[model samples]
Structures are given as structure tokens and as C-alpha cells.
Target: MTDLQFQCTGVRPEPFGAGPTLLFGLRIEEADHQPVHAIALRCQIRIEPARRQYEPEEVGMLGDLFGEPDRWSSTLKPLQFAHASITVPGFTGTTHVDLPVPCTYDTEVASASYFRALSRGEVPLLLLFSGTVFTGRDGFRAEPIPWHKETSFLMPVDVWRSMIEQYFPHTGWLRIRQDVLEALRRYRSARALPSWEQVFEELLATADAKGGD
Candidate 1:
């Protein structure tokens, strides 16, 4: 059996990724001076909403996710952020690796929505690690890394914001049902709306007029 320790040092956005991606810096250490051949690491990251305070505007935005601030004591639970995997190469005492975490801008996702609601602050995260560890100096031996092996990291909100800004600029993502999308497409075509923004503006104007009436 091997005793292992994990730590999350920092995070940064990866620019050349296919989509939005974040690279988390992780440091792994073996308790004994034993040689480690490699480790197939599986990491589950979670957002601890209750660990930090929220702003007034952010509270309002988060109502959909965690309900009102008054009931947040029970509702502000952990949200699943991402599942990342990596293979740590051989090391004797300590080793460092970059855990690449893929991200989305879709606000429909609980973690993404929670992240978007924050104005300025660090997002508390818990990284749960598991999987197989290969060791033994003479011959290779495989062992299971306990699920209890975990670490916590506070990621700055600006890191997320800057990543999104780099990819989407001032845009946000929305998910809609196929039927609803068809209806919107028809409405746009009928009104000769050149852009989706114009289509939304036209719909908003119509809704406002009806409300006034």
C-alpha cells in the first residue's frame, strides 16, 4: 500500500483548446521515499456554494439555483463542476501535473450558472481523486488510490470571466427545445429579422406593448 497526498496550487485558462478549458495545477506527493511508476488519476471537482459569501446582485441572480437567500442555509449545497483525468508520470518524492478541466458557457448548467452569478470573489472547490497507482522499483504493481484522497482550491472569479471573455467576448449561451427553436425561427423569418438580437428586441417590444395595453 502507498500513502499519497494531493494539493491544488493554482488555475489558469488554456487558450488553444477546442472549447473553453482550464488547467489546474496539482502537486502529488508520496509519503514514503518509494518510487512511483505512474498514476492514472480520476478527479471529480465540486463547487462549495456555502463556503463563501454572496453579493446582493449575485444573490438575486442565484435565486433560480439556490432559491432565496433566506432559504440558502439548506439550498446552498455543493454543485458538480467537472470531471477530469490525468496520467502522472514517474516520480520519487513529489510530482506536479496540470489537470485540464473542460468548461462550458451554457448557463443552464448548475455549475456554470453559479459561476456566472458571482461578481468578484474566489469560488471554493473540492477536488476528489481516485483511480489506480503503479509502483514497485523492481516490478510493476498496481494499487487502488482511495476515494478519500482529496484537496480544496479557491479559484478566482476573474479567471473564469476572462476565459469566457476570450472565447465569447460579450456573448452568453442559451439552450432551447427544438420545437421552441422552430417557433422562434419562424417568427424571425416572418419579421425579416436579420439577427437573433433583433429578433429578441422585436419580441421584447411586442411583449412590452402588450403589457402596457
Candidate 2:
């Protein structure tokens, strides 16, 4: 089997996409100088939270994900970021392709919550690759891409923020339970609140008053 090496050159926000998505630039090169017919690839991306330093505010915001800063060494672990798949056309020596990573604003997901808590800096990522490589001098011969094949990259935090902002500018989404949502809707209707933010603020104000008493 010909050895294939993968490199993540850079990442960017894809302007036109079905939803918020990032395009990771990947370079796949063959070491044995054999022509590649095509590659059916599946990439699993993971976030290494412990790989970078976090700001005081960021640490506080990320408490739910990694607990207190002091306990991060134990709490922080690899977080699955996304799963992406793509096919690269035939290439002789090497080829470059775009790997689309779909993103979600829902804080319910660990990866989404982690990204939102970050104020600045890069996010360390591990990319594990798998699938089949179709290559043969005469015709297309199937070869299994090793599961151990992997690469790492530091994704800029701003890129993630930008992609999210483009889809949900100045807004954060919360996936509340259906029952809670119904209660909130009823409360909002009773108070004639124009937005959910207003409802939350009012609830907080009321809670503060009670606490003060």
C-alpha cells in the first residue's frame, strides 16, 4: 500500500454554505510516487482544550465544560469537534482539497459551548482520517486508508466566531426543554414581552429583588 501523508495548510470560513461552516484546506501527498485515482475520505476532528492557555474570563465561562481552572488537568480532554467527509479527484503526486466542517450555535453541544467560551487565541485540533483510496497504475484498486493516519492544526478562534456571527449575529442560541419553552412562551405572552431577552432580563430582575429582600 502506498503511504499517504496529510497536511492541514489553513482554514477559512466558507461564505456560501447551507449553514455556518468552515473550509479546511488539506494537502494529501503520496510518498511512493504512485498516481492516485481518487480518495474517499472521512475526517473526525477533535478539540484539545488543554493544549492552549485560557484567559480568566474564558476560564470562568468554560467552567461547565472543564470545571474550575484548578481541576482542568483532569477535566480537560479531547472533545469531538466535527465529522467531515469529502472525495478528492485523481492526482499524480499530490492534491489539495477543501474539507467542509459544519458548525452549530447550540450550546448544548460540547464543541459549540467550548468555542463560544473562548474569547481569543487558537483552538488546537486533532484530525483523524479514514476511508478508501482508489489507486492503481492500470486501473482503480481499492486500498484502505489507515485509521492511525492523523494530523493536527491550530484553528484561529476568530474564524470560528466569524462563521457563527455570520449565521447568528449578536445572538446565542439555547436549546431549552420543550416544557420550559412552553412555560417561557406563556410568561412572555402574559407579560406581552417583545423578545425572549426581555423575558430573561425581567426574570433576573425579579430574582434579584427577591434575593435582596
Candidate 3:
């Protein structure tokens, strides 16, 4: 069996990607410095909230996901961030590769919600690695990578913010059902609202007036 080890060096935003993506720099090493033909690697990235501390503002925002901060000792658990796969070319001793992790801005996602709650800090990540390893020089041999093969990384919040800014700029994203969207559209059309911003402003004003009365 080949003794393989993994390490996460750094992460960066993919500027030209079709969607929001983070490319994590991964380093792979063989203890015996044996020749590796190739590796079909699968990685599961998880956000470990318990690994880091949170701010009051962030805690308030994360209430919907983890409940009150007082009970966070038990509520804080690993949040699944992404699953990525890569095919590493043949190498000897050691090699480096980029693992592309696709991301989403949908606040409904637990990972996204946790990310949004953070003001400024690194996101604690636990990367679980698996899949097949191809080795041997004369003849090809396939072996299953153990589930215990994993690594941890600290991803900067700025990297995530910059990636989101590249796509959404200063705006945030919201997902609504088709029926609810139709109703909003109807409301906007009835008032001749020029933009969705005005529609929301008008609705808030109306609610405020009702509350005052």
C-alpha cells in the first residue's frame, strides 16, 4: 500500500469561472517517495463552526441556523460546504494541484448562511478525501483511498466576499417561490414601480404606517 498524505496550502477566487468558485491549493506527498501513476480524488469540504469563535453580530445572524449562542456548545456542528473531484497526473515523490470548489450565494444553504453571518475572519474547513489511487510502474494497480485521509484549512472571509462581489457587487441574493414572485410582480405593476427596490420600500412604508396606527 502507498502511504499518501494531503495538505491544503491556500485558496483563491476563480475570476473567469462561470459561477462562484474557490480553487484550493492541495499538496500530496508519498512517505516512501514512490512513483504515482495517477489519482482520482474526491473531496468533501465541511465548515467546522466549533473550531473558531464568533462575533455577537454574526451569532445573531446565525440564530436561524444554530439557535441561540448560549446553547451553541451543542448546536455548533460541521456544515457541508462543497464536494469536488479531480484527476491528478502521474508524479514521483510529491505533487501539487488545484481543487476547484464551486460555491453558491443561496442563503437557504447552511454553509452559505454561516458564511454570510461572518463579519471578518477565516472560515474553518475540514476536507475529507477519498476515491481511487492508481500506482505501479510496470503494471497498473488500483487501490481505494481510505475515508480517514483528511485535512483542515482556514479560508479567509475576504476571499469569499471578493468572489461574491465579482458576481453580485454590493447587492445580496434572495430566492422566492414562483407564486410569491408573481404576487410581487402584480404589486409592482399595480403601483407602476420602476424597480424591485421601490416595491420593497413601498411595502415596508405601508407596514410601518399600519404599525403606527
Candidate 4:
């Protein structure tokens, strides 16, 4: 079995008041060059002020298009799983579609781990687990894809650094611990966290500046 591969084609950073947010656009491809029957996509965003989690409002427009409660679970199956077919546009071969995989976690433990890593001045990397895609009737008798568990999209440490440098050079780099400290400071100050849109503006401004040079 071959592993699934993801490529980061573009990284966009937008500003939110005092800081910025990162958005990554990705492309998924099969390793064997064989046509894929379907694809499963999942993403995770890790940040602090541990009290804050992904809110209903946070998903924004994507929520409207994809259905709410993006989180995966044993009880809720993906819409793709319900439908047996996916249409890939412009592709001559089989049409590949996307399935939303369910994710499970111990929120307390996960949050603790995130803070510990950040406290160490490390860039926290969230694991996006996409279960193996199957192809067959009833969505139950399908075979496992090669890259199912091993394949994942990594938000590389370098990419984060590049974003900070290109879009937020003024803010400077801090240890994960420092980041946590800052989050605490902001929280204590009663300042609202910046929205993703604000971060986008900052990223655009930086890109525009560089383009002129």
C-alpha cells in the first residue's frame, strides 16, 4: 500500500489586531499514480488560552457549505460515506471524491499537551487524522488505501517561521512558553483575540510590500 501525500502550495497569513492567523491551502495526491476512488480531508487548529476552542462561529463560510459539527465521531458518519459516488472535475479517469473522517480525542489531555509544547518554545503541530478511504458498495466493503494512516498534511515548522518573518517581522519569535505567556497577558488584559480576517489583511500588506521590491 502506498501512503497518501499532501503538498503545501500556498500559505496565507491574515492579521487579527495585535497578532496574525495562518491559513494553509493544500493539494492531496496519491503516491502510486493510480486513480483514487475517493479522498478524506481533515484539519486541526491548535492554539492557546486553553479555555478557547473551535467555536461554531469560527468555521465561518466553510460551515455553511460543508454542514455543521465538523468534528468526527463514531455516531456521526460523513456525508460522503452516505453517498457512494464522487465526481472529479476535468479528470479523465475515475472521479475522486472527498469524505470527512471522524476524529476523537481527550480534550483535557490534548489541551495540556499543547500548552506544555508551547511552554517549551516549540511550534505545536496538530495531527490531522484521516481514516483510510474505501472503495466498494455500501461504503463498508471497501479495501484500505495504502497511505491511510501514515499519510498526512504537516504544517511544517519552517512554514510557520516563514509566515512570521514575512508577515509579522515586527512581532519577533518567541519560545512556546513565551507564546503562552503572551496569551495569558492578552487574556488578563481583557483584549479580544483577533479574527482570521484581520490576519489576512496583514499578510496581504506584507505580500504587497515584497511584490513592489
The candidate that achieves the highest lDDT relative to the unseen native structure: 1
Q: What value does the lDDT take at residue 98 in candidate 3?
A: 95
Q: Write the per-residue lDDT of candidate 4 for residues 1-213, one digit (tens) a residue.
A: 434555444444444324434554445555555444554444433332212233344334223323445432231221211111122232222333332222112223332222222211233233233444543332333344432232223334454454455655644332346787666556545644374345446558779999999
Off by over 4 Å in 1: none
Please give the lDDT score for candidate 3: 0.93
Candidate 3 lDDT over 41-90, as tens digits, reads: 99999999999988888888999998988899999988999999999999
- Residue-level lDDT tens digits of model 2 in 1-213: 979999999999999999999999999999987999889999999999889998888988998888878888899999989999999998988889999999998899999999989998999999999999999988768999999999999999999998988888899888988999999999999999999999999999999999999
For candidate 3, the per-residue lDDT at 63 reads 96
Candidate 1 lDDT score at position 193: 87
RMSD of 3: 1.1
**CA lDDT scores, all candidates in order:** 0.94, 0.93, 0.93, 0.38
- Judging by TM-score, tell me the better candidate of 2 and 4: 2
Order the numbered candidates by lDDT, best leading. 1, 2, 3, 4
Q: Find the 10 residues in a row with the least total lDDT in model 1.
A: 67-76
Ranking by TM-score: 1, 3, 2, 4
**Regions of candidate 4 where Cα sits further than 4 Å from its true position:** 13-22, 43-126, 134-141, 145-213
Stretches of candidate 2 exceeding 4 Å from the true structure? none
- The alpha-carbon deviation from the true structure for residue 21 of candidate 3, after best TM-score superposition, in angstroms, is 0.3
TM-score of each: 0.97, 0.96, 0.97, 0.29
